[model samples]
Target: MSAPTEVPHKGLITASLMLATIMQVLDTTIANVALPAMRADLGASSDTINWVLTSYIVAAAIATPLTGWFSERYGRKEVFIASIIGFVAASMLCGIAWSLETMVLFRLAQGVFGAAIVPLSQTFLLDINPREKHGQAMAIWGAGIMVGPIIGPTLGGYLTDTINWRWVFYINVPLGAVALLGCAAYLPHMARRIRRFDFIGFAALAIGVGALQLMLDRGGEVDWFNAAEIWIELGIALSGFWVFVIWILGTEHPFLEPGMFKDRNFVTGLVFIFVIGIILLSSLALLPPMLSGIFQYPIITTGVVMAPRGMGTMITMIAAGKLLRVVDARKLVVTGLLLTAWSLYIMTGFGPQMDSTLIVVSGFVQGLGLGLVFVPLSTVAFATLDPQYRGDATALFSLVRNIGSSIGISIVTLLLTRNTQINHTELVANISLLDPEFAARMSGQLGGLMQSLTLTRGEGAFWSVINQSVNAQAAMISYVDDFKAMMWVTLCAIPLALFLRKPTARPAD
Candidate 1:
């Protein structure tokens, strides 16, 4: 039961949809850097401050199941417009909140409504246009979604450093207003049969997804398996996810049809999307802290360095969109993964002596990899899915990507934390056992003995200085080793791609 496609002003529809998606995507990362300033202003703890991010993600995950249902029950145009208005108002509230709790609550409201814009925008764009050109629609829309994070932190860093963090929220107002107005005026009312809302499915999905994100995000921070709250959350997540699957399987009408997951190509496309999601976001998330904290880069400088990745993506997306009509998508993905692996290799080569030139090169290469793979993957996905099923597929794709990012960040953060401790420990142990020759030489330099700066003993503190030097080098080794581990993980995509289907010269029409 493929939905009949509509004729459209391909260029204009593409513009409006991509603009909406860009605004929403930007909101996801822009507030992240502002969290520190938020902490200072609200006098909150670091652990508590992370709720600004976790709440937003959890809200989106909980509310995402409604996106396709709403689009079908109402009109895509109506839902899209309402989403823009809701997101804008929430952004205003976020900027003006007087307390940490208020700001977090407002962000939840923002995420709940804001969750639909990205997938729906893409869904709408592809639906209105000729099926063969959906890849072009994806190209236009992906430029916004894929490039948002790259731009967000730099923009956030600049705003926080130069003016105020409130500007991050304030910045969303104009962009969102324009998008809302444009959508209201220009978005088409494509005629299609709508379905009844699935109340039971919605409840199960909310319980399952909300509990899952809550547990994953808070569990590690709270010391997993030790807290009573976490175990309860675990129970909710398993029950909800498993039960939702069973319920959706039996329902005559579901929020998401159980049949959508049966498409081999759709399943393959999802795996690739998740892999790319993890690679792109985890890298962006790690870069700001690594550059500013470890490498002594300023906020603005770190943000600026990461900007090349966005630039590369923008360039490659348009180029790859045109190529999808000619190239095999799986081959493009394979090539893109190798390029991504190579780009990560470039990143791996960086050490304590890294400079702007190296950062720029690595970011640009990685961006190229993203752009090359993303467009092709997107084009092929819709090519195989009929219009009737596009909404279902789109929602699932978005969910996988979001989950991938959560998993990616959590894994990287934990790895860095543990490795830092191990590296520091080994460093301490080796320093204590100082080489026989080096110990003698160090002792001689310090005038023949160990001292704790007690002048009464007539001794100098020499061995401590040597130990300090040893500790510093060990710390550097640890950071570098952790970085190498991340680079290796980037290669994980290659094996995953082996299962992808062949890409043809044109999208299905």
Candidate 2:
């Protein structure tokens, strides 16, 4: 592989690629807010409907490692254009899906086509831009990648509310078409190589990623290790990973090149992004439900309140891009981690009756942290690596981040469910006939109400209100615990930044 040939329409190329990047990243979180609507429309059960998301996630993870090989065998322009077309077609199919099964299948197809977009987009942007401007380029790129997840729910909610859940998928059509045209017109046809396909490595990696994703996605639903299916998935994930490790170490041409990982900065960046993925995406996953369920906000209102988060990230990313010229990248990462941890800590203190201001403020702060970290981290990660490795390295980077996000979402969701149950039981156990404190509390709050309804102590109506209150409180506590856990995770990322070496200054122009 040689250095990227210059394209005359760099601006058009960048815009087109960013459009595709945003379109793809938006799908990651956009479907979440519409899940209820989908369940109702498709007449699917809670457990089964989630395959709409799970299928896409698993398919994308399995196919991501193919980017390098695809780009190598076929030129980058060919693969990218085909991906856009395929993804657009899949989105249309998803929009028109008549059943849950069809929806899952369409989503899986979308994932497979969309997997190459991000890594290829990153690689293309890096290739077009001068080394000195990598920070600025990554900032622009990072804004699309990072802010899409933040904006996804709000956009999904608005579309779902105004039109229908199908519009969530339909929205991709026009965007994808425009991107495809721009890419076709502006992106250069890079040279291709006749690289040998590493089938064994790919199969092993695919099995490992596919199994791990399934385990993470379904573990909570089936009670983790207690279920035979969960145990089987776990065993498969471990076995696949073990095989992949051994195969990669020995294979001459592995699915991923071995030398890519040998770069210290690149390796450390992987760990950094993984932890960042866990905290960043997991918080986004937790917020909407908390707003709708705990605070009782409408879907549109939840989206509106969350808008500030993306704004914060957008503002800081541009600033971080400029600051990279004057500041140490490692310091920026550390600062970002502190801000994220601080926001999470604030979240842990949220009261059940708190106003939306807290949500907005903490979200904004977290967004700022994410922007500061993502721009510099991306710029610095590949600063020292060979240009030829960019395709593979970027793919692996995206894969690790996705895996971390999957694991993080699953962990918090599981903890929230289990902790709610534990807290509910404890609260219920203390609400007995002998406890005067419980009696006084219940009587004071619902005395007149119960009297109006002719309800006696320990009656269904009386206990029903009490139980609802207990459940709400328990869920709030569970949410707070999740926040605390995320804060610690953010704090833990601080040490990893120490391992990253600040790139030396480029020569004076």
Give me the candidate number with maximum TM-score.
Answer: 2
Question: TM-score for model 2?
Answer: 0.96
Tens digits of lDDT, candidate 1, 232-329:
99899889988888888899988788766766677888988887777766777767777776578877777777888889888888888878777777
Candidate 2: C-alpha RMSD to true structure equals: 2.2
Error of 1 at 108 (Å): 0.8
Which stretch of 10 consecutive residues in model 1 shows the poorest summed lDDT?
451-460
The candidate maximizing lDDT is 2
lDDT string, candidate 2, 219-308, tens digits: 988898889998898888888889888998998878788988878889999998888888878988899888989889998899889888
**How much lDDT does each candidate structure score?**
0.77, 0.90
